[model samples]
Target chain A: MTGTAEPIVMDLKRAPNVHAATQAKGEALRAALAAQRTGTGLAAEQLDALPVPHRRVERWKHTPVAGFWSTPEAPSVQTIEAAGSEACPVPGLHAYRMVFVNGTFDAKASDLPVHNGVRCEPISMSDADAGSQGPLESTDWFAALNQAFATEGMKLHVAKGVILDRPLLVHHHTSGENNANFMRHDIHIEANAQVELIHWSTASDSSTGMVNIMTHMSVESGAVVALDKVQDEAGSLQHLAFEQINQAQSSQVRVHTGTIQGNWVRNDLNFRLNGEGCETVLNGFFLPKGKEFVDNHTTVDHRAAHCNSSEQYQGILYGTSSGVFNGKVFVRPHAQQTNAYQQNGNILVTDKATINAKPELEIYADDVKCSHGCTIGQFDEEALFYARSRGIGEKEAKAMLVHAFIGDVLEGFAVAEVRMEVEHRLAIKHGWDTWNDTLESA
Target chain B: MVNIKELQASIGETPILKGLNLEIKPGEVHAIMGPNGSGKSTLASVLAGREDYEVTGGAVDFEGQDLLEMDATERARSGLFLAFQYPVEIPGVSNINFMRAAVNGKREHDGLEPIKGKDFLNLVKEKASLVELDGRLRNRSVNEGFSGGEKKRNEIFQMAMLEPRFAVLDETDSGLDIDALRIVANGVNAMRSPDRSFLVITHYQRLLDYIVPDFVHVLVDGKIVLSGDKDLALKLEEKGYDWIKEDVIA
Candidate 1:
């Protein structure tokens, strides 16, 4: 996995073949890294050794990556100034802000406090070696690319028995056209500690871009952690995110991901229950309009006994957009008395809209209880008519029914600020003026 | 307040209400009783502008306005309400929120400002007590996990909240116990006014016992075959619908 320090330049005159796009991007990325002289700790041989996802791969079967890979690559780093905290989509949530622009940390716009036992600092390539897990072991192509090109990110640590009074808001803003931004975030919550972390990503202007993010989180025994992620990039951009979570004994972790607007978005989330009496909850809501596409693949591994996990993902597709949801729960042989539940529900507004949902439960334990359900349907005609019969207009009634359909997932958010922000975004997406007003007032 | 003349309707090609005619005056309670598949529910549905029941040829005037020309929501906004026999179970929608939307919708249609939150809450509490609806149900999802009796009482509670000028009770007594029936009847009686009327459609005379109707009509084969005063309901209950069916067929 070692190679010379020579730059591997890419040929821009190559034909636009999606099948060869991944190789072409890899070559171009190596040259870009070598030109900047920023060692990524990943050798060219290691990158080439990783397998790129294709149509034949089971995980990438539903979501096509041809267009994503074929898009023109942008420089990894840009000299754009980071927007102020006032520009955050979630107002009043910048109590402790960490801002990043085009994969470059902006200290001027960030608030790095020195709280008791709370540490927040940028992670360099040298520090990446100290982590237990590395991207070379990950089979995912996107994870390898992130490892090769990532230059700016954060490493947050909370000491044992310490609780942060305010949430840590990490803002990732993309600017400039054709920019390829790669980022990595790691969070470690020590034993008996409690903290809330929110990651908000948005684009400053309408531009064709690409964003790749990977997050690794660990929660120690008796700790509580809530991680909320919101992505609303430009419609012409593409995004790929990978999250890995490990929970210890008696620890509780909740992760909420809301995809409000994006052109092409894919989220890969995996949770590992390593100790007994752990609880993990995953809730997601995705809304795609026009020709946008969103796919979510999640896996929960119950490796210990007496663990509990529940996952629910709801999608509302409009126009000619499409969505995919694949949820799997695995109970190991020794994980007896485990409780795992998974549900995926989708609503296709127009006949042109499409959704593919799959929920699977693999249980090897005899005393385990695991169930999974998936439903793809339109709005309930009876419920719509019932609402309309009460003098509510057709549009408002439809919005109300849609809200009701996804209300459970929103209600599952443990953080009040995050939930309200999500509700506000939903109201905007569905054009519920009165509902938006009500949310604002509340 | 409502006048139906030569009302002809059908579901697909199967005719339901065949050239039916009825008149409901203000401050009056009219009961329509029939055996199964006798167009009793069809009449209620057609009046509430259910799209499934096509109006082949009919004209309905409510408060001097053409009712057939209006859609379901328009009819509702124009003060026409239907207490469904089987209220739909809407998950994750609070009962109070649903009621508030209905009230505000009606108010907006009347060119009035939205009701204040405090006033709306007070109204809900006052009207809910009329039907003895539990306070906990107000915050729960609409009709979700509700008992048969609780659903019936919720219907009446919703009716009181909307305060429509005219209400059509379609088999509202189908799944109610004795106590629930009395509470529902008491709610209806309490809402009665000089300018409001009700069209009660039922299969039994027990509901009419507490809230007596001014007139009774027996619908058979999609038409009213017998019309009389309140005595007609008791007579039909005592003799059974078989006699009415035989009379109409004969």
Candidate 2:
């Protein structure tokens, strides 16, 4: 609401970090320019045609890029030795711990997996990395940016008919002054292959910093893959993350992303079904307290016959934190029998906090089921009253209804541990003892 | 747990219940029968502290406190339970979870820690059994997919769990068949004690046969026009409300 004609560039780095970041960004760009690598050539070309996007672009319309630009200049680059641990550790059964530090692959600290037909390779100039999420074609601008600049990125691929019971864990930890970390991961799976992968992004510090990352995923026909992305960065970091989804015919793709921590962050996700009978699910939950800002924009396109896409995002905001959720679903002309659903729901605790929700549906086919809705509400007053009247207190009653509102989303999640832990942590953010005591009259 | 004196209540510009009076003590079941538009449900809503219904003229006391002054939830927490004729179905909310919150809410008000998971589960189990509510229904979302009988039974089950001091059975028998009615009545009968009171609101005497009320009142034109004993309910069932409105309140 302020009057400003110039790009509101908020400097993020102090003097020391800024100078090193400039040099690192330049070196990373030079590396990609030197490589004549293989990928969807179109992806790289798209990256070449576009400069670092500014506020002028409509696609990046609502996002505040100043948070990314005005950041304290990049911190001085530290060698892998200077940073103690490779990546933040999460306990579970992980087959491979692929560690990336400052966008460079730390091979010495990384653990390799024995699963056949699955390859984890680091591509700089001559090598190429691939994985099951999707094949990164050369044409994706974001992927190209990562390929040119990524000091370290992983390529994971699954062979047809191979199912890995354990999760392939990818860890990202960024540290240092001369930091311009970019990564492009190309994932591919043979037809009829099934893969389960968890991409864990976390930073060691809650101090102020910046991170911008994108993942490109393309799943082949008859392939089924379940992807879980968790963002558990500290509250003082500025995070700009994006993911692109491309699905083939008769394939099933499900994505569950939870925003566990961040000070200021914006994530964009796009899912496209290119073949018949493809099913894509894009679901997310964001819980922001304090002065956190978490924005998520998603688009799903049913481009072929019999494709189905559903998007549901739940947000719980407290304090002066604000959240924005914008979603769109499109049914192409020939996409008959397509079913697309999108909904965004937010709960605000304090008066100063705000939620901006927008849902849009575009249908070109007459015989399609498309729906979109957005709601900004607190816990249901009647429901709360009903519980309290049973002799429950105000705090306890509100907590009951809040858990009730989010129970549906948590139930739909595939990972039990993630869902349970999310509920536990979210309860804390809402300032309740348990899931049952954090509600107020909304 | 119940006291009523010259009870007067209204809604907006029109008066719904005018100069109505009734009384009940713990350990007694009273049935209030009336025809449509006779302020039967209004009595329940007003007692439950529904803000839309204005209690402009009547003085109501519940368990010795000013009932009308409290909010709906406060009224409920104060031992006033109204079993809605059409139970509000909260989507995505399981019955077990809902009851846990409610029971724990009540306990917390009494300065108690939350019910343990094991204890709460068993509590719902035993109470749900009282109403013969299907065990499977307890795990499903609250009233989300319930049938007529199931919804009524769930209402009674809720009452049993909360152990309200004064309960209003608003049209509990309206949609129930003979079997469901009998089960609901049995649950009510099981909960009868010297410390609790029941007000059964119905349009017919058939429910009276199951609930076996100690007093019967005929309500019409927003007022309790006549009061009698069990025999009065039999009389109204046979004679119909047309005669009661014309011969009594008028």
Give the top-scoring candidate (TM-score): 1
For each candidate, report what fraction of the true interface contacts it reproduces: 0.55, 0.50
State the DockQ of every prediction: 0.49, 0.26
- Mind sharing the TM-score for model 1? 0.91
User: Per-chain TM-score of chain B, candidate 1?
Assistant: 0.98
Off by over 4 Å in 1: A1-43, A71-86, A124-137, A436-442, B241-250
- Report the C-alpha lDDT of model 1 over A1-442, residue by residue, as the tens digit: 0221111111112222334665566566556655654546663465666545655556667887756443345544343353322435575664587878777777767787579999888775335453434544345667777776676688888999999988888888877667678898888999999998888887755556678888888899999998888887764777889888889999999988888888898998988899999999999989888898999988888889999998999999999999999897888888899999898999999999989888867777889888888888888888878877888777888878877877878777766777788778767766776551231122
Residue pairs with colliding backbones in model 1 are none
Model 2 chain B scores worst on lDDT over the 10 consecutive residues at: B101-110
| Every model's TM-score | 0.91, 0.76
